[model samples]
Target: MRNLFFILFILIFVSCKEDVLPKPKAYLSLKYPAKSYKKLHFERPYVFDVEKNATVKDSKNNWLTIKYPNLKATIDITYRPIKNNLKELLIESEKLVFKHTVKAEQIVSNDFINESEKVFGSIYEITGNAASQIQFHATDSTEHFIKGALYFYTQPNYDSILPAVDFVKKDIVRIMETLRWKD
Candidate 1:
C-alpha cells in the first residue's frame, strides 16, 4: 500500500510539472511587384500613366475609379469643367481634404506644377487613421479641373493598411507627375 501511494504521488507530481514559456512575437509581411505604368488616354480632358495592375471603371460623367482588386482599394477621379467655379471647386476640394482632420494625425500638402503642361494643383497626404490616405487636385487654372482621392474598402486601420497605402501613394504621385491637360 505504501509503494502504491508513492507511485501515485510520483505520477501526480510528474504530470503536474509543465514548462511555462512565453509565445514568440508575430508580424505580418506583405510583398507587391514593381509597378508597370501604361499611358491612359481617357476621352476626357486629361491623360496620365496608370499602373497596369489596376483596372479603371467609368463611374459616370467623366468620373472614374482606379481599382486595385488585390489591395481592396480605389482611387476615385472626378472631372469638372471650370466655368466660373474655379474658386468654388478649390474651396470644395480643400474642404473635402480637411474633413478628415478629426481622424488625421497630419495633413501634408505638396504643390504640383507643370507649367509646360499647364497643370497646377496640390496633393494632400493625410497621415493617420483617416478614411482617405491621399487626395489631389489638378487643373489647367483656366478650363479643366480634376480631383482624386484614395480610399480602402476595409475599415481605416492605419497600421494594418500602411503597406497598401504607400503602394497607392506612389501611383498617385506618378499620375500627378504625368498628368497632361487635353486641348
Candidate 2:
C-alpha cells in the first residue's frame, strides 16, 4: 500500500509538471500591477503626430502616462519632414533633456543606427530612489519621442516594471518599424 501511494503521488507530480506552459514570448516583457486604463491622442506640430491610446486619467483630468507614471509616460509619436536632418534634431533633443532633467541623474544615451532606414535616437535613464527613462527617435519624415518615468514607490526599479517598459518599448519599436509616411 505504501509503495502504491508513492507511485501515485510521483505520477501526479510528473503529469502536472508536463502540463505547465512555457513562458510567453514577446519583443519585450515586464511585470506590473493589475489595473484598468483607456487610450488618448495628442496633437503636436510637424514634430510628432499620432494617435496614442491606452491612457489613464486622474480625478483632476490630468493625463496619466501608461509607459511611465511620474513624468507623462505619454508618448508623442509623430512624423516630421527630413528637411532639418538627424544631426540638428539630435542636438535639439539633447538640449531638451538637459533642460528638463536638471535634477535627474542622466542614465545613458542609446542609439538605433540603421543604414537602410536611417533611424536614430537616444534613451536617458535617471536614478534617484526611483528611476525613469526617456527616448527620442527621429527620422526624415517625422520624429517619435517618449518620456517614460516611474515613482520610487511604484516598483523596485527594473525588477518590477522594467519588464513592462521593455514590453511597451517592443510595441513602440514594432510601430516604428512598420511606420509609413502618409502621401
Worst 10 residues of 1 by lDDT: 39-48
Candidate 2's C-alpha runs over 4 A off are 1-72, 84-87, 129-132, 141-164, 180-183
TM-score of model 2 (CA atoms): 0.43
Per-residue lDDT of 57-164 in model 1, one digit per residue for the tens? 976778889999999999999999999899999999999999999999999999999898898999999999999999999999899999999999999999899989
What clash pairs does model 1 have? none
Q: How accurate is candidate 2 locally (lDDT)?
A: 0.44
lDDT of 2 by residue, 19-59 (tens): 66888865534344443232233323212222243443332
